[model samples]
Target: MSVPVAPTPGSAPGAPPGAAAPGGGAPGAPPGARPPLLSRGRWDGVTTALRSPAVLALAPLTLIIAVFFLVPIFGMTTIAFAVQTDDGGTRIGLDNFLDLSSHSRAMRNSVLISVVGSLIAAVAGSITAFCIAQIKSERLDSVVAVFSSVLANDGGAPLAFSFIVTLGNTGIIFGLLGLEAIGFTLYSWQGLVAMYQYFLIPTMIMVTLPTFVGLRKEWTEANTSLGGSRLTFWRRVGIPIATPALLGGWILLFGSAFATYASAAVLIGSGGFPLIPLSIDSLLGSGLGAGGQSTAMALGVTMVVIAVVVLFFFNRLQRRSARWLQ
Candidate 1:
């Protein structure tokens, strides 16, 4: 059933295999004629992409993370169980865990600081989101949103320096206010809590802003029409619906504060009270100034475990809350 046309000019009979194709399009085509690729359908491109080696493009990034992130975690865990001999050789065992009293104190203080800061930030951020959502002017809301976005990720060494400039022992603001009569220490626990809120609130705002948009005003009106007080309605309905996003935001803030090193390291210094991160940096970097490296490694493993556990709960909260928010 094959009807034969004359062989193409460049694809003559008995030609070499790759010399040209029968259509004279791919390997060779008539002058001024369309190329084979232009004649192909859209599905061909999709199929080509699917079959391409480009799918493994992220392999390098994945390999880098495995080497840098997971390797260090595993190394830290291994070192926690290792001991140094008098002759300078290292042996591995459970000796580090045996004396975890000071480590426990540092872990507890770090958790306390992170939790308190995150909660304060989440509450403040939620209220700000609500206020922003209720704004009459879109321009104002946009400006505030842009400002919050900038502040959210600005908690680096510069932020710590700014705080120091504004509130340190010999701070400019303190001098202007003439508050030398009342004593204040910027390196104290309270100062850390306040400094944490500066960044954490913005983090919370970004995280929970979507939830504000998800909130339906009709639900509030309906609750009011049903004779429920605003407080009662918010406590029973609004808070329940928003719990997932709130908790998720709080967890984000907590993780950021917990892993903070530069700010604490810069402002508070190693001489400050042993927050877990500070302790780790001091023990390992300062060669156990008043602590051991194995202990620091053990604290690091403890943080990894805590992060995993908290994220597990945050994910569950998200799934539950997404039922309404989505």
Candidate 2:
């Protein structure tokens, strides 16, 4: 005779103790059966509800970028490729790029200026940051922090004017020092780099300060205990830890210097120096010649390419540094 199975626990009265409920006739079916796919107790529904609001909020940002940023970039790319007609229509071609090669000097000058200025700023800023972070006095640290904060926000036209007033011929500083008639001009490419550094140094210091704080003092002490000189410690330990942040800050500084227009424009005048951004402004406005516009766009493209390469190297450095730290 077959063994009788008891009804499953919690089943209706008179059902065998091990028998399944009305849903099925198997023993212990309730615990062993698959759970309901959309059970209210499951985490999937809760997670979906929690994430839905965030997804909804991001929709506006997505729409804004699509409409404003991507659309304009597409239009600029189109303009960079097409030849402009006298009647306002563009004859689509590669003439724009072809014209860029003719003004290679300006391109080279801008790249050289940005690279040199950024490297100088990075080195100066890193040293300043290292010094400030290593200091033991709270008051001095607060003062430096305030200075960095002020300079970081101080850019654009006002900064340009300030530099002009300080270094420009016939300005107060130059005039009082009798440098104006001595053939000193702070309105050249070198002058622009100097002005850029005023802001770049402070900005880089801010970027690098946090990295300095994150550095453990133990490394320096350990190196000293091992008879390593200060220079040796810095070369072997300090730089490796800080190199990623240093390089990243430099990349940002370079990008900032590359894109700056108003400062250079105010100091040097539009035609005197032809940095890419300055050139672009002139091309879009009074310098609306075909060659000017094409060359300006090409220079803009070049600046972006340089920025990309710098950022890529910086990120690789960061990853390597992080691994080393670990």
Candidate 3:
């Protein structure tokens, strides 16, 4: 017998030679060989394309922030430094800031009003929130909700006008009480604080309500089971948990009060209680060129600074409370 010819390992026996492998590649790839379908760079590109949905989704929000928030802030900051010339040219400097700071009475009044108003709102809000949460009556809760909704949206010139009618010299309350002859004036700082509280209380309640709702029923039950008094329970469990909401609400209230102008303008009747906003308005209306605009901007900047500082502390307090709650 002739020596058996060794069949080619990859070829069909007694059939055509040099037939391609089914996969069009060698049976076993080399240790470091890349797949023919997708190299590393191409794979990376595919992955990047797949991730583009996130980018697309974020684009609209990014555009909105850039256009509305960031642009306005940048423009205002720029104007704060610019000095306006007779020919409408601008020279950038710190003169505007100096002028704003020099208006000490306005700055002082603004600070005081904001602080007092915020504090009052915070206290009232916290109390209202606590009471609403603890109360079992649905009708009362509904009333509170409706009341808050009305007050929170009440702002600007219309709100000022409303307050003027409600709390002004000829206000319904004073008229009903027949106290006009007794010289009841809602145009004072005290009246402003009270008017601010009308809205502030509702805002505070809304802000703090969630915090109250978040309180564990078990905590209250356990406290009561342990014979802890209501006051003790509040001190030990309630305040700590709600501190963040309370502080945050207060900061928000302060910021709102700081920026308020229409209400102050309407109630105080101009020049009598020149808060920072009023001062800014006067400067802008004075036709004092870029200097006035810059000064007004600087005052705005100061208000922003105050708000930021309050917000920072409030945030810190919130974090601490969260940690304690956890």
List the global CA lDDT of all models.
0.72, 0.70, 0.72
Q: Which candidate is the best by TM-score?
A: 1
Q: Show where candidate 3 strays beyond 4 Å.
A: 1-68, 82-93, 137-150, 178-183, 288-290, 319-326
Per-candidate clashes, comma-separated? 1, 10, 1
State the weakest 10-residue window (summed lDDT) of model 2.
1-10
Give the clashing residue pairs of candidate 2, or none.
Answer: 6-16, 6-17, 6-18, 6-19, 7-16, 7-17, 7-18, 7-19, 8-17, 8-19
Q: Which digits, one per residue and each the tens of the lDDT, describe model 3 over residues 1-326?
A: 01111122223222212221222233355534444654443233333433455444555676777778777877888888777667978787877787765799887887788889889889978887888888856677667778887787676677778877877787887788776676667776777887888778888887677577668788989999999998998899887778777888898788778878777877776668778888878877878554677677788777777778877887786676556455
TM-score of each: 0.72, 0.71, 0.71
Instruction: Indicate whether candidate 1 or candidate 2 has the larger lDDT.
Output: 1
Clashing residue pairs in candidate 3, if any?
A: 84-290
Per-residue C-alpha lDDT of model 2 across residues 29-107, encoded as one tens digit per residue? 3755643545533333333433444444545676677778777666677667778789998787777777766666667
- Between prediction 2 and prediction 3, the one with superior lDDT is 3
Shift of residue 291 alpha carbon in model 2, Å? 6.1
